[model samples]
Target: MPGITSPPLPAPDLIDIHCHQLSGSDHRQILSRDVHELASHPIAALDRIEALLTNRRYLSLGMHPWFIKHQTIETAFLRLKSCTHHPKILAIGECGLDKCIDTPMSVQIEVFSRQVQLSEELGKPLIIHCVRAFAELLQLKKSLAPTQPWIMHGFTGKPALAAQLIQHDCYISFGKALLQTGSQATLALQAIPLEQLFLETDAAGVSIDTIYAAAAKIRGIDPINLRRQIHSNFINVFFND
Candidate 1:
């Protein structure tokens, strides 16, 4: 398979905390690619990571619960662990619990726990993907007490959920859902503390700029100020600088 490719671009003040497909925008993005997608070709996975990093791109690698298989978990996780040390690999997930998936909750917990441990061991933050599993997810967070930040990406939950997660020190990221008027995401975006928030495109195929614009409008702020605030949150969470 072809490795991920992108041309060199100037460093962006605006940031996309998580995305699957690369966009043709100038802003910085942390691409979220599953390690399991290339499990059979470890070299290709490494090469893709290398190419992205070589071109000043960033990414987060993880084994998503939806793709978790008893047969492939070990091999895929080994592959994921091998690449965690790279500086450009900013976070350890897109991984978390999902009650909607057919995968057993026990198995999901085991895999997600492993990644959580890995993230802690490596001192990297997490980009989380959660669906209808907040209870279990919050339990894990309380028990683990991980020092690194856990960003709940692509959140479309109500303001209460966003507030709960923020109270626990987890950052919430909004995506294409923000563009939809009267969406839970839009309402939550308005209520979320600016410092504990982020923006993304996920696999939505929308431009990060569009997401930012929608988010700014919902929060009654200029796009440029929104960009600056999110960029600041990005640095504080990912780089701790």
Candidate 2:
């Protein structure tokens, strides 16, 4: 008689810290098998959020600073406040200061601060999108004294900036830029501790598997080890698993 066979275990899901593709679009086919993605939706996309929650997808919502330049802040804030407490909303941003944008810095600061307060009130983490305004963002994080984790998504900053953000207990997420040798993202990846690092695909067409491989190569470790460590970080930040 043949020996009894054992069933195979499920594959571990690769955690993508932030991705817009999974949220408001029909591009869901792009998601590879064995991926746990956090979809980020801006304030304008909130209209479809009820459907997202019905589907039980993990999400992050915020009023991005770019919208403040083109739209009314009052209406944006109203929409943002209404959907913040949704059970599927795991984080409160992709919102943060952006000095490079047309939106006045003061208005951006005002809007960003409110989102920070909302994240604090809800006890959810923040998915920060900062550009040329790290100092301001850092200052605000200090002043707010938030207890929840803040992940700076798509980080391509210098090692010093990465170190500073990590010092303040912020998690740094790297994306496609990790493929470029001698890039700031690569340097920062080398400097940051594994526990504080995350990998994201953001709006890029690249797969998270590609990102994991690049990161593991840069860190000189096996891809499985990197994936396991980041899986642990994802649980620590989002699920407390």
Candidate 3:
């Protein structure tokens, strides 16, 4: 209801594919919201989302695996479903398998699977959050064969893993890790095809422009070119539908 009547913002030069906090400036972004956070206080969370949509902010909504408690799943998922029809809700994620979390792998898989179905049904991209569960994630992708894009956000994996996910048609998004010397993200960014790549700040508390500059330096290209390529990637994935 909010974004439906509001005018869309101009195309952004720099796109932050996934982040928790919204920047004050008019940078393009997919602001992520975990449904777990909405379970206990649904009205408050939905109100916040409405305010964001009213302001013409794009959103990605999903249930993060780490916070998947059995009691809250129904409530959280219903809230997630309610928000998906909003035009400004661009993706269905920041969700997926995380092997290190205390939540059982079985539970994580089930919750993530539901979100996967929702994404496919709505024809929206999925922004994933994976940790030490590449094998399981890949297998699920293979089995499901979703038509929508799945972006691996905040990636810190090695080049081999990055290539494997790209091969599986997943876009890789680099974050603050790219700023570190000799980091896996920095190295992998150099190898990833520009079309299959994206950049984000996630919850790193850094400017997206800073990440773009660091990534451009690593890939031996001008920051303007990197920004342009990522803007193209963002349109292909987020607006293709």
Q: TM-score of each candidate?
A: 0.91, 0.83, 0.90
lDDT of 1 by residue, 30-147 (tens): 8887887665776676786567553446888888898886347888878888788877889998899998879999999999999999999999999899999999999999999899
* Residue 27 C-alpha lDDT in model 3: 73
For model 3, residues 1-241, the per-residue Cα lDDT tens digits are: 5555767545346888888988865678788988776756666777777686534368888888867864577777788887787788899988999888789998899999999999998999999999999999999999999999999999998999999998999999999999899998888888889999998999999998899889888999967777778888888887775
TM-score of 1: 0.91
- Full candidate order by TM-score, most accurate first: 1, 3, 2
Off by over 4 Å in 2: 1-11, 23-56
lDDT by residue (1-241, candidate 2, tens digit) is 9999898544446777788666433212111110011123443355454445433246777777766665566666666676677667778877888877888898889988888888888888888889999999899989989989999999999999999999999999999999998999998999999999988888888987889889999999977778778877877887772
Question: What would you estimate as the lDDT of candidate 1?
Answer: 0.85
Candidate 2: how large is its RMSD? Answer: 6.0
Kindly give the stretch of ten consecutive residues in candidate 2 with the minimal lDDT sum: 29-38
Clashing pairs in 3: none
- Candidate 1 regions with alpha-carbon error over 4 angstroms: 1-12, 54-56
- Scanning candidate 1 in windows of ten residues, the lowest lDDT window is 48-57
